[model samples]
Target: MALTAYEQGLLAVQRREFAAAREQLESAGDDPRAVLLLGQLAGEGLGEPVDAAKKLSLYERAAELGSAEAAYNLGAAHANEQRYKVSLDWYRRGAELGQSGALRMIGVMYATGQGVEADDVEAERFLLAAAASGDHLASFDLGTLFAYQRQDPVMAAQWFLRAAKEGSAPAWRELELLVPRLRELPAGDTRARTMLGVILAFHLDERDAGAELLEVSVAEGDPEAQRSLAFLLHDNAGLPDDKARAMVLFRTAAEAGDGYGAYNLGVAASDPHEAVRWLRQAAEAGVPESYPQLADRLSELDVDEEALRWYVRGAEDGHKECMFAAACWYRDGFGGPVDLVQALRWYLSLLEVGSGDGIHEAHKIVSKMTDDQIHEAGRLAGQILAADVLVVSRRT
Candidate 1:
């Protein structure tokens, strides 16, 4: 009867009936499997808003009863909620019990100072444990840490290669970018083919090799690698810059929802008519870079209203250039009516982000205005610059 109840809950989950699944699973007793299923259902919100509290409760219960999956899930949920100290505790417990994912999470927390004081040596120790256990994600994290955080490119390359061999698509892509420098190393001899495969897949101008590697990765369901190779073949970035081929690759990557691929395709279209089409597609897909470029392109075409709208979008998306451009337009009435107050606000915002051009232009504009306006602008700029100086000092 209990098994039937659990099976029914699973079926309800499959059919997206969250309420029914939760009801059924709750009655399935304290079985670890049932609790895990219930927690996942609550966490994902198949039919309700995510109840993180409930999910955490269920996972904690199951974990206390010795379910490895539950322990890992509990730790992850805590980490996501930024309860880092609690997450570290759960992760350490799970890691001690031989959970590779937990070990990796602990490593990341130590490295990032999420809940604990950052300790690179401890992070590396935990990461090495996870890597030795064949955790591909852990290996990738370690590689990225060495490459970007620690500035140890040699160790970074080695960990990246290990992760790539373990089928980490991002690591493979990053390795493609790093391989040129890696080849200069004496130890690169043994990794020639793997490096070559990444190059052919992402950076080389040889379609045959790129296409072959792409096809293999695609068949193997490596989305990022497939997208990279497709881009190379389609843009002739790998072969000879063929627009037709690039369009095909762009279409494929776009369909698969690759954000950068969609943005690149939008940029490559060149036709103002098609620019809006691809740019809108990429923007809707959450590519922030697409908004500013689309605004600039529209401005070039003299489509002022559309351009201004996209500029606002770009500004909202935190593009410094777009903010400066929009501020100028507002100051001079280029696309819409002039509004000095709005222009000043936007310029000040841009200055906050360290846009020298925006700050200079804003100062020049204010200088020509009434003496009162000049004083106000100067005061605002001084405040912003003071804050920036404080931030820089803290970092140092």
Candidate 2:
């Protein structure tokens, strides 16, 4: 079948045969698609020297030929040139022709009052309309509007999360910006203070500021705040170094049924039996960190069988230390009978989770294993890594 000139031009562009693409597009005649492509090529200087006047002329011709994208391009060009009112009119034309990006620009213009009166209502309406039409950047703008103008962190967080779920990198920046404004929420809402403190300490690295926020929640008997503040105080990062106070806070939070606090208190306990008891509770409470910690402490107490069980669980959960320990135990027959294949497989598994330590250790013992065993281990590790990559890709 003979291809249309427009389609042939597209094929030429894909192959980087820019001159042929331009000729083919020109020969396509009155097709707005071809005209738009020609204007884009001119604007991008694809097949010739950069000519702003030529690009603008081509865009104007394309826009006259009913190309919504050309209208949008003209809007962007005018906006970049500081022709705000002209850009707004072009953007409105694009929006009238059903361009979500144009709608987003109109919302931004109204929000900033660049070429229109500042109207939060209009900004919210247009931004929401664009966002609901699958414009992810508009979701980010809506988040900023709520965060900066409305001063509503709760609403801002929702919009930012939506943008983030749609893969907007700026959405995370908006989340960070909202953290400061979260302080304005009512102090009676300990949940807000707890969240604010956690973000400040961990995400922003403002430990002292985070501690102050956490103190407010702690005074209101918030266990989560107690745990976070305790972790900061015990982190050994020059933040007052009050291990005793941290220990008390950990104990307080642990007794209130905080799994992370229990895990920390278990680590800090002097007696092995007490540590094991608290760690067991933490593990039962579904704390992933407790798995590796409990395994190590149990191994110290010479409880190899139970320790190996926790190490295997943690290894499956992608804990590097547990993977190392599990491999070593299987190789040395410390917890059970020697199984070089299991050790090799666990060692290879570490590479999937972004570590090379397991493979490094595997090299020493691969000589002791059969060729078939090594092959099987490599196959299993490859399958696990592929599955993990697929899951991560789906998330982004």
- In model 2, the clashing pairs are none
TM-score against native, each model? 0.45, 0.52
Cα lDDT tens digits for candidate 1, 1-396: 012466557656756677888898888887777788888877877677889788888888888877778888778777778888888888987887689988898899889998999988889999999887757699899988887778665577668877876678898677766666655655323333334455655444555775664565555544455456655555444455555655666666677877767777778877876877778788877678898888887777898887887787787666888878778888889778986655665677675677656655565555345533433443443333322332234346
The ten-residue window of minimal lDDT in model 1 covers 383-392
- Give lDDT tens digits, candidate 2, residues 141-253: 99889888887786777687668767888876776877757867887878777777776786677888989989998888899899888888887756564777898899899
- The TM-score of predicted model 1 comes to 0.45
| Candidate 1 Cα lDDT to native | 0.70
Error of 2 at 39 (Å): 36
Identify the runs in model 2 with alpha carbons over 4 angstroms from their true place: 1-172, 235-241, 359-369, 383-396
Predictions: Cα RMSD each: 18.9, 13.2
lDDT over C-alpha atoms for residue 103 of model 2: 94
Each prediction's total of clashing residue pairs, residues at least 3 apart in sequence or on different chains, is: 5, 0
TM-score of 2: 0.52
